[model samples]
Target chain A: MNATIKTLGLAAAVTLAAAPAMAQEKLKVGLLLTLSGPSAVLGQHARDGFQLAMKDLGGKLGGRDVEVIVVDDELKPDVAVTKVKGLIERDKVDFVVGPIFSNVAVATHKPIVDSKTFYISVNAGPSNLAGKSCNPYFFATSYQNDQNHEVLGKVAQDRGYKKVYLLAPNYQAGKDALAGFKRHYKGEIVEESYTPLNTLDFQSELAKIASMQPDAIFTFMPGGMGVNLVKQYRAAGLADRIPFLSAFTVDETNLPAQQDAAIGMLSGSNWAPNMDTPENKKFVAAFEAAYNTVPASYAMHSYDAALLIDAALKATGGMTDNKEALRAAIQKAEFKSLRGDFKFGANGFPIQDFYLVKAVKRPDGKLQTEIAEKVFDNYTDAYAKECAPTN
Target chain B: MTATLFFVQALNGLQFGLILFLIAAGLTLVFGVMDFINLAHGVQYMVGAYLVAAFSAWTGSFGWALLLALPSALVFGLLLEVLIFRHLYDRDHLDQVLATFGVILFLNQGVKFVWGAAPLSVSVPELLSGSVEIANGLLYPVYRLAIIAAGLLIAALLYVLVNHTRVGMLVRAGASNASMVSALGVNIQRLFMVVFGFGAMLAGFAGAMVAPILSVEPGMGDNILILAFVVIVIGGIGSIRGAFLAALLIGLVDTVGRSFAPNLLRLVLDPAAASQTGRAIAPMLIYIFMAAVLFFRPSGLFPVKR
Candidate 1:
């Protein structure tokens, strides 16, 4: 029995020694998203975009076999932390992505930073992390939370609106949005009302807005709340009388539900469906073919994140074990992004052009955003100045 | 202008209260009669909205969708009672809660699978598409007013069914003493099933009615479910009249508080502090009211003599 055991052990050692020479090392990517609750649609879009990018590369990153593990955070911060911990400890993922909401990002990113794993945020880019709290290993493929709203603020100011009523849900992101709007908007603020998140009815608030008689109404209600508010605003005969200006509220996800009510509504975003670019044209076509719906801004961000990772891997010649090479490659930002002129700013957030878009009826009678004008060129977040330069 | 704003807000409060009553009436009935704590009650409301949305698209008429969805919702509720809820009747409250909670998780995901995760919109029927002039220069959606009228009509119907009918007498007796009613040779299980099915249908009706005005998405019923519980507790569980008064009172307090709390607090506190506190306290007003009511009346405002 001793002779047989010695022979088996010798054989195992020989096979293990020869394994690395024959096959490349596997790259594990962990995706943490709010996949099962109220914000599930956002997560679904992110997942689809990531998968599409993988498919575009023929299911390999940097010529190395890849394994992706997706987890649902359920939109809870604590749940996000737990899932992220599991990703690092149990799954042993080298790279991490996702968490669509800012609050979830705040909770999940600290552990990733401590563990020294590469984190690419697909949706949320909170200001706290972009400024003094910035980490060397963190990058945001999406815009900083305030950048899109800043564009809307500038547009509203340029339109000569003297008095604007601001509305947002009561939360961290809501406060950030209002602050961003106030930065560039040089107008008299009529009223700033913070309604409870996920509120279905807005009649009372609409009544107040009507009484105040602001020149325009600016809001930041996202998801289903956005749909309800737009529908009710039109139903109340307020949409026509008062020009509506919003950010992240009248996007493709909720535009179908808003229908004619959304038409003529103005919003500012980094990427729209009708942007005239070859890369964007290819992305929108492939996404619609795969998902049978127009891809939203969240999906574009996730697609960009995957492409960014692929570019870094290729630049390093698939040497993921070399941390310095990988980080330098990502910072180079050489990938062709659907959003034109994409690059990483000092804060590791996107420096991309933002546009003023209006909801218009298409030839096919579908509601879609039509880019009216470029609002910002190679814009960086306010917190970029606070980030210390490492290079 | 202030007076006009006040009048409009009051009307909004009344409309919201009527919707709350519709949901709480059924919940209180099921809780009061069977002693079964079914946490999945909210999912029934969710199912109702999904069914209406699906049917409206297929049939291309809101009226047809309503006509078809109600019967389908009734059948669905009856099926649920027979398949899952019936086995849970004899179990303890904790077991019932666990089992029903499992149902909620299952059905919430089930709806998402059937109808994708995106929120669906049901267009208002052409007959009710226009706005009505409530006061001079004040236009309100006719659909919202229609919701109020329908809710009130259902409340009247429910009152008559519970107070002035044979089945209602059985329900009352069953609520008071289930074992004694069983001793009198009444099929108590059948009575329980009837109450459960009818209660579910009522909740479904409320969901279908609101689908056009509100976004019909998964988990939409969860928040309103808590508010309905507060309404039932404040009204005294098992009393339709209590549910009515408590629902309206809650609706008015919540609407008025949210609208004017900041202005009222500005009298004493700085504007910034007042607005912050007002937003923080608005969502809690119903719960505070519930605690106060329960403090004075432990059994609820109109607890039946069970």
Candidate 2:
């Protein structure tokens, strides 16, 4: 009898030893993105947007103190998995939201899914994950990678732009953007160009595209590269010679440097500063009032990401541990999106409006996204049809 | 392609090459002399551009902004050195890589935190604003040609300093053997600071010069950092002359290859295949060149003593 009691005691001790800390005083969150290098500008904006929402939440979420553990993936997939493991296993985060680059997300998705930790991506909706690879465990708070480009493609096609030259960085997101453009654009594509992922120089690509003498050039260079391309295009005197249609190319972040170059360029965007909505206006005013800066695209989506997470937690009645419940809550898209009427598709992407945004200098000497054009009032991504949710 | 179009494209290549050289000169120096790989070096360039934009606005003169931004860049470099880089001088390359990488994170965000993420423009001085008509029907922006001239002039100045000055002699000595330089009573530590500071300012100068043409924004330097790395690697980490040549080569290759790749492929394959292959190979061309150079000339085209 004494031995039996001792054995049971030993078993109990072993269980306690193996188990994770059960204090549960805080709900740890993991944020992974390219916090350094060229993409840092967007990453910084994202970080700000995420923190702004947390501040709005009075420094807590779901009645638990929030501890956000941010990691820099250095824009590498391997680094993403390593940092994510640290967050999930070591930090023991309750939920994970992050990884700006699509390739990084693709690399880290499997391990995260297997761990059963909810992944709410702030940006990058690679089509495969939105379709066949769709998992109940994953949700995207930002536009799917294809939606922006697809919208641009449709608009370009409608405009009867022939001999379009395609340009994007040589990376997974770039490839996806090209594929997305191809899905909607059926015009005679004169040529396609892929520059280095971190390349700032676009002169050669510019010259080559000019050589083709295309009616228009379509580009997907975001952040600084977008700015570089536009500025150089204007300097090269190609702006007047050709129509430069792009996806996520010129927005508030890039439009200022572009000046005259950005004036007539067309793009696809989910949120623009000029988007007229009470929610958008509130977001813009609050952001400008708070930071004294115009809101970039990153700020818009990342704010939505936080709100989406908050909505999921509230919908689940503040129960953070139930994965299925949280997934279902996110799928329902119960949050008040700054972008207006935001809902999640079966693929876990937004089923919201995709505006055909034009870059125009605001009367105040700063550039702004005016809704001079729009491709779809309510856009459904091309890959949504392919997502058989039930599997 | 028309001759005029090709000539314009070649000029574009030259302009791109010059910008690459400006960045690579500073980057390669740090790598070659200190054997330190700074990932945050790009942030230095970003700082340059921002300083130029803000100072130009504040001072209301491009000349003053240029003058003010140079010292600020040097001061910024010195601050970074004391704060983070000093500890990294003797650390392993991996740790140095990570820490400098951290500085990039802090500064990129810091810039956004202070200046915001929006792109800011530094207008080209009124003197150099318009375009210049070249050989045949090509009107090129005058600022671009000026950038090429500035880069070449800097290259010559760098060569003269390294090959013909007292500080240059000491720099060469330190790069060759820190132990010997120390034995010879040279202040190795101070020398390092000067090199680091000078390199930082040069990168900043590049940023300032380019800012008028390109938009100044956070994370502006990252792509140039990669190209600079490629130039240093291809040219030899410690050889400034090699950096000059390799910068031009990479700039021309990247620009020319990207332009001609599809057309070149069209000749060898069908139009569809050409476009696909060209798109696939264009970005890889420089990387392929780097790999080839590394394989053939392990230490680069010109390996410094260190």
Candidate 3:
């Protein structure tokens, strides 16, 4: 058994060594995301979007033949840590692009950054990374975690809502969502409730909402939880009585399942499929043609991440050896973002526009979010000032 | 909380409990009679939801979908039993666990391959689509109430089926001692198959009933599976009566505790601290209840007499 194992290991080593030498020098990218379980749709879209961008570039990034390794995080932090270590140590990827959810980002952030590898986030921009713990190697192609929720908070305040009930899955992101909402909406918070992550049933919580009859209800449920909550909220007849304001809960990832139940629901977002720009229009059309499903912000952000990498490589002339040069090029963000006017804050988070998007059923009978109104222009995150100049 | 809110919460608890009971009933019976730990039982529930969703889209009527889904779920359960599970019945518990876990992974991926990862929308039938006012200023969804009604009716049916039938007598006997039943000339293997399939259908039925309300997606059964296991363990591994009572206790504790935990804590702790601590503790309350139960009655509240 020992002799056979040794033989197999030698054969594997030869295979790994021969392929890269035979081919042109390839840029290896580790694409880590939650690709299983209920939230798998989010990661699937992100993967497809990144793949679409790669296809648009003739399967190359910055004129270099690229090899992408996709791994499923399974939305478990421990599982993510192990998988990311393999990508770093065994694969020796030049860049690590990943992580749909914030918890996984928090788990893999240190390991990827400490290895002197650039970590480009497609989604999941947790607040801590935008502040004291920010690393030069880490760059978020997505908006800061609090920005989308802050848009909803501002909308609620502008609409003159006196009291709003808030709900979110109890986790780091969930807490951040409520805090972001509270930052702008100074009206009385009628009540704040946090359900455990992935909770499907909201009957008890719905009962509480019915009794309170607050001016509006704000929530931050995503993926399957969002689908269930929207359907349940509609069934409970609260959608008609209370204004529903949210972020991520009523977006494209869930709109397909939500259908009529989610129509006219307002959500805060950085981009939507219906945003009117030639580049966005072309990207959205191509994405739908390839994937046959409307692209969510998750997909949009990931596509942008791929473009960001390509742009950085172009500036560096595809040379990945000089870490400082690559980091500087990525910080410049020299790409036409699908969302329009994208640039990085000092902390490597996006300084971009946010919108109060509303869900609508299109003429094609597909449900998606459309930009209802622009809420912020060139918005900078609250935590950016806390990021010290280290690089 | 006000009286009306308390009453509404209690109703929600009952509804949630009934769903838990439906899933736990099958799990307890299989564990008790076969002495086989089938971790893939949750996948059976997921399959049921998927089956109902598909039928609903194909037939364009939820009622017809449900009617067709029941028999289909039965066939699917029996198919799994024949294809994979029956062979493991005589194996040790650890081997059975590992094999069944593989089945769960395979089936979860299989469903995704067939249905795609995005949740399929299953609409509530028009007959039960709206909300009804239960009390002054209190409104509840008619569909949820329908679920509660259906759950109760099935519980009553299960009670009669398990207590009065000759097959049930053999099942109880088999749970006590399978070798004695075999020695008495009963085809104990066939009896095990029957018990296993019936339990799977019960779980599937629970899944079908909630398809309209829940996200009919892959791995949807995982969390509920944990809760169902807690119900069976707390109630007693084999006792139908114990499972029913314990399921209700767990459901109420989980639902009511989630809402009231912070309020109760606020009487002592500061509001922020109470809310944070409450959110942390509420999800764990059921396990705490299970632990407390095991401490008092290790074999469960209604352990089968060996």
- DockQ values, each candidate: 0.64, 0.36, 0.56
Candidate 2 deviant stretches above 4 angstroms: A1-34, A50-74, A82-95, A115-117, A256-261, A305-330, A333-335, B20-54, B71-121, B133-138, B152-204, B215-250, B276-306
True contacts kept of 3: 0.78
Once fitted onto the true fold, the runs of candidate 3 whose alpha carbons sit more than 4 angstroms away are A1-24, A78-82, A85-92, B264-277, B291-299
Alpha-carbon deviation at B105 in model 1, angstroms: 1.5
Model 2, range A32-99, lDDT digits (tens) per residue? 87877556656766777788888877876655567888888878899889999998899988778887
In order, the TM-score of chain B in each prediction is 0.97, 0.96, 0.98
TM-score of each predicted structure versus truth: 0.94, 0.77, 0.92
lDDT of 2: 0.80
Q: What lDDT tens digits, residue by residue, belong to model 1 across residues B1-306?
A: 778888888888989999889888888888888888878888888888989999999999999999998888889989999999999989999999999989998998888998888899999899998997665556799998899899899999988999999999889888788889899999999998889888888889889999998999999889898889889889988878889999999989999889898888889999889988988988888888889989999878888896
The sequence of per-residue lDDT tens digits that candidate 3 reaches over residues B81-186 is 9999899988999999999999988988999999988898899999999888877656788988999999999999988888899998998898788899999999
Model 2's TM-score against the true structure:
0.77
| Candidate closer to the true structure by lDDT (higher is better), 1 or 2 | 1
List of clashing residue pairs for candidate 1: none
Model 3, position B293, has a per-residue lDDT of 97
**CA shift at A77, candidate 3, in angstroms?**
3.8
**Residue B166 displacement (Å), model 1:** 1.2
What lDDT score belongs to each candidate, Candidate 1 first? 0.88, 0.80, 0.90
lDDT of 1 by residue, A85-165 (tens): 999999989889896998888888789988889999998999888988888789999988998899889998998999999
